[model samples]
Target: MGGGDGGDDSVLHFVFVHGASHGAWCWYKLTTLLDAAGFKATSVDLTGAGINLTDSNTVVDFEHYNRPLFSLLSDLPPHHKIILVGHSIGGGSVTEALCKFTDKISMVVYLAADMVQPGSTSSPHDSTMAVGEEDIWEFTYGEGDDKPPTGMLMKEEFRRHYYYSQSPLEDPTLACKLLRPAPLRALNGADKLAPNPEAEKVPRVYIKTAKDNLFDPLRQDRVVEKWPPSQLYILEESDISWRRVITLLFSLSRLPYSLIFSVLYLFFNYNAKLHSWFDHISSLVHYIKKSYC
Candidate 1:
């Protein structure tokens, strides 16, 4: 499943949404894999993230931060539909997009993300804040000493343990160099993720990381129970396992939304044999196509 034969040239696009303090750069590996499989993959940098020139301090609210995704969706061809994948707090932005452009989205996937209720007011950063003040670097740049912090970044010392403990050494190193300060106001703003009827109707798939340090397994379970997805797959690995998990997940694209449940359940059982699982899964896809597709 690392690379497709490029035999199917249909326009199946994947739009990846990165987590807080991260950028489009983080999705490099996954996007490359998707592209190899003859699929179109795009990763967007939220305002004040990635190479976007917007200053982090000036990002006033969640909506402001999500402008890039909205603009991309608005400009897409009417016949195109996308698979939106969100990681961590990017789930909020994904939800916002779902509410606004429900018709344009074919499916939504949340990977160890903040899959909160439609009108939840709690900040997605609440979990990070619980990690203790020492693990973060908060700043009030350009503001007086009396004002609240304008931006925040995970302290370099704690970044590895909290985010990349199970990842390769090089991934954490790249993150340290590229990670930027997340706008504090925007993350902690009063904006609510209010979902509409259309958004709720869209098929959703939630992927949980068993060893996720930032969003623990318990929290992931709670969110899933609150708003159950069309299908759920738990990776007995780290938050960074998208690189390995995405290959099999994308292969399931040929099956219609209703047919993904049983196939996904089988994927988790053979996840340990990830390297060779693709061939088996590819055969499974052929069978599904013959029987259901």
Candidate 2:
């Protein structure tokens, strides 16, 4: 399903935030697709990720995660309107950003992302929360050395199970090289999301990745229910044919924006007109039959 408004805006700016154990590099395919589709897209690395990987001291809390986003928004071209997209735990940061900078954002897109309520902290095993697990993939920096500091590096096995399962086209060598240790404090830090009355007025789109093992579709639905979106979309992994998974992934790479806008359009204008009265009647009959059965 589609989510936001797709107008003839001069430039659609997409700010993508990756999930835990992931750096900005994760959005490479998405960025390419968005650019090709005529949208200007940039993926931001949280303080401890990608080019900013060495900025360990700067990445201790949620505030640290917001630093790069705040800087990017502050420096954006005066006329550009931004659509902030966050994946998994990054959703908390995106919501925080929207609360902090309501005027600069056109919409916020949560891609199977966390949609935590204000004044709430992500719960352990909440996949949406940033807590690090004791799995082999997460290796603390000081595990065997006296250099005690930062956190652990993810083991290849864990990464393979969670992150790379869908990246069949990615080179094995490059995927291994891109792996890095995430900050422990950042993972354990309590989320400090605040209520934003303004954000309520701002449009929101939530994309549910149906096959996500970490963020199961049912759990994702619960999160969405807590903070209902202007529009919701379910991108079923099963929908992607074996041969077309790559192409589907590439085509839907810019979906965070396209889907949002489409949903907005449907919600405001086309939804009522598109539904047939007969469909409702048929649904009622089916429901009644199921109830009796």
Candidate 3:
């Protein structure tokens, strides 16, 4: 059954966590889709990224770097449970958060990300350092010869090859403009993503990027082998950003998380002949709810 207005507003509240050198701004398209379909969505920018004022270098570990996300999770309404979606390095953040806040989370979705475990010693300090030509670390210009390290910013030049290689040519230009310096320790330091009972309690899903250059498909598969999720999805897109907005719509078809009629409305919000539409799609939700689960 739908919410009071026959809308899917409360079926699930989604919180999107972005990957390296990115921020909440990355989920623009997905938020538009969710808004149209009557779902609540939020994208979090970790410290030192997006509009946050924190210095990245000061963030010595994952806990401090991703404090914004954990804070958001902690502050959601007492009864509200979020479906956390982590992209790339953000997956590691999700892994850590689950240990402390599983009760507030309904599901976890890893989107072509580095799924780090508690004792992961080789997950790399950060993907931005290992992959691509930009070498975001190269942009480490001295704030002052005398000042201690605050954090390193990914230069506008390198973000394209490192992040938006698959997105629209212009998207990289725009996104890079908003990029901020991330702490070196976020990737290199110890962040206790150590497996916890709370984290194990929630259902999880993994989406593999078949043509991903950053994490690579093989490594993504290996992460899955290390700790399998409740469900797995594969995304095939040459331009990853271009594919990101639409992939969720396609991937969600099999989720059975929301009623089919609700989703049909997302596609055809057109008016007229409403009765026929209702007649055709109503039973599907019931059948799925009864037999599929």
Q: Estimate each model's TM-score.
A: 0.85, 0.71, 0.75
- Put down candidate 2 lDDT per residue, 1-293, tens digits, no spaces: 11123454345577998877577888887677556555578998887777774555335676775688788888876456687988877887787788878888888888878877666655522554322454554446544456545565557766665555655746445767865666666755535656668877788888787667567677888888777988887665422222222222223323444433553232222223324522443354356445643
Question: Could you arrange the candidates by TM-score from highest to lowest?
Answer: 1, 3, 2
Candidate 3 lDDT over 1-293, as tens digits, reads: 11112333334567988877789998888777666655667898898888888866667777788789889988776445477888877887887777778777877888787676665565633442455453446434235557655466656565666566677777777886787766666655534455475577587877776766567677788788877877776665543232322333333444564432243233323234434644555455456546864
Q: Residue by residue across 73-145, what tens digits does model 1's lDDT show?
A: 8887655558798988888789888888998898888877877657766556575345544445556564767
RMSD of each: 3.9, 9.4, 6.8
Residue 252 CA displacement from its true place in model 1, Å: 4.5
Model with the higher lDDT, candidate 2 or 3: 3
Clashing pairs in 3: 57-150, 57-151, 118-194, 125-187, 153-181, 166-239
The Cα RMSD of model 3 versus the native structure comes to 6.8
* Quality of model 2 by C-alpha lDDT: 0.63
- Model 2 misplaced regions, further than 4 Å: 1-9, 53-58, 121-125, 129-137, 141-152, 169-173, 238-260, 263-293
lDDT of each: 0.75, 0.63, 0.65
